[model samples]
Target: MTGYSALNMQQKQAIAQYLQSLPSLVELDRDDGVGLKRALGNYWGQFLPEEIDSV
Candidate 1:
């Protein structure tokens, strides 16, 4: 909660949205781990850019 406590509301919401975008733990276990990791990275990358733009 150290860094998390420092985040603004929009930043927090963006992170929440990113978490929502993630595959469930069960899904991740069932799928190709490497591929799912890559997709999660890409998803966060896309989310971050838009959040930055808004700032």
Candidate 2:
């Protein structure tokens, strides 16, 4: 449940830059869908299934 507040200024800037670098629709039919999904999962939630057998 970490928040964006945990990211440093540099990290935030890097993310912004990555997002901005996406190609326009005319240039590419698809973009970095995988990276975007991972980033969203990390920023929004754990996204992983809970462990059922933790000791």
Candidate 3:
């Protein structure tokens, strides 16, 4: 929890109440039968400033 805790102690504290329900949604993805790891957060500047498909 070091990575998350460092960024948002207050936010982390708030979501702590729901810790008991932290089951993996990926594990329950019945449609695909093979769940994929979805990356969280916005990467506004990680790659190119303009996307070819942005048009």
Candidate 4:
């Protein structure tokens, strides 16, 4: 994952602004009922059925 230090000035500023906006966003309900295995399955979409269920 790209660290904050790797970002340029504009990217850092954008991240700062996004962070400032996060408070209101945080007020929203965040539950999506998904976990790592299911999320990976959705994102990858190519895991074998048995592989997805194995863990």
C-alpha displacement of 55 in model 3, angstroms? 66
The lDDT values for all models are: 0.59, 0.53, 0.34, 0.46
Ranked candidates, highest lDDT first: 1, 2, 4, 3
**Candidate 1 lDDT, 1-55, residue by residue in tens:** 6855788778866775666566663455545666656654665344454444563
Q: 4 in model 1: Cα distance from truth in Å?
A: 1.1
On a 0 to 1 TM-score scale, where does candidate 4 land against the true structure? 0.39
Candidate 3 lDDT tens digits, 12-40: 54444233223343244453332211211
- TM-score for each of the candidates: 0.39, 0.39, 0.23, 0.39
Looking at model 3, report the run of 10 residues with the lowest lDDT sum.
Answer: 35-44
* Tens digit per residue, CA lDDT, model 2, 1-55: 3877788766776665555454433243334666555564565224333459978
What ranges in model 2 sit over 4 Å off? 24-55
Listed per candidate, the RMSD to the true structure in angstroms reads: 10.3, 11.0, 12.1, 12.8
Q: Who is ahead in TM-score, 3 or 4? A: 4
Q: How many clashing residue pairs, candidate 3? A: 0
Question: Ten residues in a row with the worst lDDT in model 1?
Answer: 43-52
Residue 35, candidate 1: C-alpha displacement in angstroms:
19
